[model samples]
Target: MFTRKQFVSASVGALVAGTLGACSSNGSNGGSAATKASDDSYTLVQSGKILGASDLQYPPLSQMNESTGQPEGFEIDLLAALAEKMGLESGWIDPIKFDAIIPLIQQGGKADVGLSAFTITDERLKQVDFTDSYLDSNQGLVVKKELTDDAEAYLNQAGRKVAAQSGTTGESWAKENLPNAELVPLDDAIQAMTGVSTGLYDGCVADLPVVSNLTLNSYTDLTVAKQIPTGEQYGIAVSKDNPGLTKALNKALTEIQGDGTLDELKTKWFGSNI
Candidate 1:
């Protein structure tokens, strides 16, 4: 008989072939980051735990819980589920810089994985390995409420300032699509939205799901003027050195897809499955 790992890993890639329209998530508070390093089934950075590096500011995917003072979001819950399947607990690098997440995973000793809604790109694949995509994403054009007249065209004009998180696909999209507009690279995705809300920028580009949630709830002053399909997919980042860990996560991810847990989580957080 094939091992569960063998069965799951074998069909992993086939499981999430087509991307789904990612929806916003509302997550439960997560465990705190730990310092201990030891393990069993796999040589994890920490014993009985999966240590992750992430920027805990992007809502629906990852963010800090105001009430609990801990990380909370879809990615956090997803990581927790993956860890449970591997008989490990989940913890993370609280409030790390978005661009620095991959580097910390590459350096080792700091984190075993990165789960900050990272897009699976050819360039990022060279630096770190990615698990099967969990969600399909697109870029959103977010503009201030006052920019009611043709927000997209208005922001597309020359000298119009646009904000996007540095080192992200949204920034790349702005560079390519909004070439006439000035691109301001912010340190965090929320900062870009805040800048737009406060009139510091005419607009910003970020993940559509995040923009949808924020515009509908947090930043009602902003609006999603456009959903730019970039064919981007989000993945859990694993180190090249940790093949066992990668294999373990892939197996767990496959199980989640097969057993309806993924659908359940999607509904719980996003209000429906994609």
Candidate 2:
């Protein structure tokens, strides 16, 4: 019932709407919560807190506890330490989709720094500058224990289905490398894990932390089939021009890594320092 031009407009509108829904800082982007910090304020440098992160559901990094429903994870702990070291008050932002986080920062300046287990890559670097590597995670494949051998035998299987969260490095890697496989992009880690468990997908591609977390706690049926360890790592991200913020973040990050807070949190969550 829609004309070609009208359909195109509608599709574009939908994408925008979806992005806004994911990145809205506060209610309808209103109130004190929605306002951006003033550049003239040095307090914005030392004492300023900028919005960060999307949702807290990626385990070991950020996740809401199933028992207590409280949010706790490695990234949250690291952010807390960084905030204290930087003399800034950390403001928590709500549930933005993973892919929307970078776009919001680039186009809208939505968050000051994004730390959602984001992988650092050459392709992503063109869009935004990244903090030094805070977490190292290789591209990994998770498959049913029974089908693990199949994936090991044939790295790419035509007519088979692979799943990953939209806008993530996993999705990009799968699309690029697994060209023969049907790729399904879900919105979050939970969905990707569930898809494999439900037999809706033959395998799921994700970061190592995601593979470990799901295999240990949620998806017992799944196991890591292969790991692409070309030395990929995750980093905190900010707008390219915001060198001041990046510098401050790097200082705080260095302190955390030096004082062993990062490793302490890593061991607590992951059972080993990654």
Candidate 3:
């Protein structure tokens, strides 16, 4: 029987293989010519709806409300504001796997945008465009209380297992920085932290806000050992083919920022700690 750790590792490996194949075939459709129109003339993927795709498992950023079965998070609220400002109806916000959302955007027609806690990077920019960043972030480590202060030291040693979400900057950071440690790739931040709490992993690497939020709210046994200052920034992802949508989102973002709506949302969700 495979342990949970083995199963997760195998699953991520398969996902990476599938993602590579999908990317090769999709290769930026640029969508229909209709999607390439000017910002003022562009139409929604679906009439009267601003379709969004996200993995809503990360709390404070994006999570599902179990009682209402509706998506609710800082990113969700921000997207709602953007959709309203763009004069589109509150359309379908589909829940999707984090790594798959970019591919869906690249393929087009399925979603108009992606608003998970997507950190904008040059590599990601090659596949899809991003609106102006709304949040600055850093990579953080979460470990069991026993390893709290010495988590970094332990992670630096060989045979230590450190987990991170596959395809995220946190994973890349772990690979680059902890070359001697065994890198465990999980599906999301929540799972990575859970693994740490259960002693499946020595530590979990994820966004600073996410690790902090989870540690404070849900996983009291976990502590943020170190915050790696990567100076990351989260942005709303749009298809490379849909420059018009990108422009419109940027406009809405600027308005929210200028009118203090952005700050208010940040305070409401992240508090002064962020």
lDDT of each candidate versus the true structure: 0.77, 0.72, 0.78
Which of the two, 2 or 3, has more TM-score? 3
lDDT of 1 at 255: 88
**Where's the lowest-lDDT run of ten residues in candidate 1?**
23-32
* lDDT tens digits, residue span 1-274, model 1: 2232333343344345543222111112322223211121234554556788888888877888889999887888888988778766888866789899988877677788898879999999899988889888898999876665777778788879999999999999999888889999998889999998988998999988788878987899899988898989998888776655677788899988899888888776666785
Least well predicted 10-residue stretch by lDDT in candidate 3: 20-29
Residues 1-274, candidate 3, lDDT per residue (tens digit)? 2222333345457567774221111112233333211233343466555778888888899888999999888888888888777665554456878899998888787888888888998988899999999999998988887777677888988889999998899999999988889999988888998898888998989999888889999999999989899999999888877676687788888988988888988898998626
Candidate 1: where are CA atoms >4 Å away?
A: 1-41, 146-149
**Ranking by lDDT, best first?**
3, 1, 2
lDDT of 2 by residue, 47-112 (tens): 246557666768778887779866678887788888778665676676688888887666533566
Clashing pairs in 1: 38-47
Q: Candidate 3's error at 265, in angstroms? A: 0.6
TM-score per model over all chains: 0.83, 0.79, 0.85
Evaluate model 2: give its TM-score: 0.79
Clashes of each: 1, 0, 0
> Judged by lDDT, which candidate is best?
3
User: What is the lDDT, from 0 to 100, of the residue 112 in candidate 1?
Assistant: 81
Model 3 bad stretches (over 4 Å)? 1-39
lDDT of 1 at 268: 69
